[model samples]
Target: MDTKLIIIETTTDDKEMANKLSHLLIKEKLAGCVQVNQINSYYEYDDKINNTVEYLIRIKTLSNYYEDVKEFLSKEHNFELPEFISYECKEVSKDYLDWIVKNLNK
Candidate 1:
């Protein structure tokens, strides 16, 4: 079977937490690369609509590391209920895919 490439996504309201998580993932070799972007999110809770600014963290890694990544995020994330979503890359460039595989811990 081909190597499964996935992009795990999560959000955080704290900038420091986002940076910390990104660094931890890369340093631990759980993620090949991590991208963080500031975003505005609108959601409803307790029958009230709320809008907040957050940091969107996109983690690039292999499927084999998903569980580790999830665990790390769950433990380090500041939000009560963090968003842990993964999207498999159906089509990736050979060069990019190889780079990701090479960067991840064996």
Candidate 2:
């Protein structure tokens, strides 16, 4: 199985959403770990040229699970245009990578 790290963004800055998603991912054995952080302004959308707060969730999972993870995100996400992005890991610390594989198995 290939390991992948996904970055998902939401419209609202509610920490609760991040927490819930993280728990769901782990509980369902779809992701190893999820870290949510408050980030500065990135871009404007919907004619709103202003600064806003946002949370970035970093999820660790296998490549094959992206579709399932995306589905779960889409169904639970409140934003109409939530960001669904993924990054392939070419190299990672052995210990960390092993942790991901272990936690992501049901």
Candidate 3:
């Protein structure tokens, strides 16, 4: 059977935090894999423009776990308002998709 999947995205200013989140998700079976990328971000907050280096975390997991993942991220995240966005996977490699489903514990 083809499994439904989603990619959840978030960002952190510290690599340690990124690693922590990544490991937590995998250890809890919330995500099959997490990819971290160093990125430069510029945005406005509190009436000022800000630029900073950040780590983008991409979490891949079954679509059914989206809400659980979102809740876990919000509670464990350090940011006052963490970015928790999800993109549904319309297409994925059959084998890779199977791997993701197999990894989920719930």
lDDT for each residue of candidate 3 in 16-56, tens digit (9 for 90 to 100): 99999999999999999999999999999899999999999
For candidate 2, what is the TM-score?
Answer: 0.84
Question: Which model is ahead, 1 or 2, in terms of TM-score?
Answer: 1
lDDT of 2 at 11: 41
**lDDT for predicted candidate 1 compared with the true structure:** 0.92
Every candidate's CA RMSD: 1.4, 2.2, 1.7
lDDT of 2: 0.76
lDDT of 2 by residue, 1-106 (tens): 6555444434446778888888888899878878888886667668877677877788778788888888998898767767787878777788987878887764
Q: Is candidate 2 or candidate 3 better by lDDT?
A: 3
Q: Each prediction's TM-score against the native?
A: 0.95, 0.84, 0.94
Off by over 4 Å in 1: none
Candidate 3: 10-residue stretch with minimal lDDT: 97-106
The residue pairs that clash in candidate 2, if any, are none
RMSD of model 3, in Å? 1.7
User: Can you write out model 1's per-residue Cα lDDT over 51-94, one digit (the tens) per residue?
Assistant: 99999999999998889999998888998889999999998898
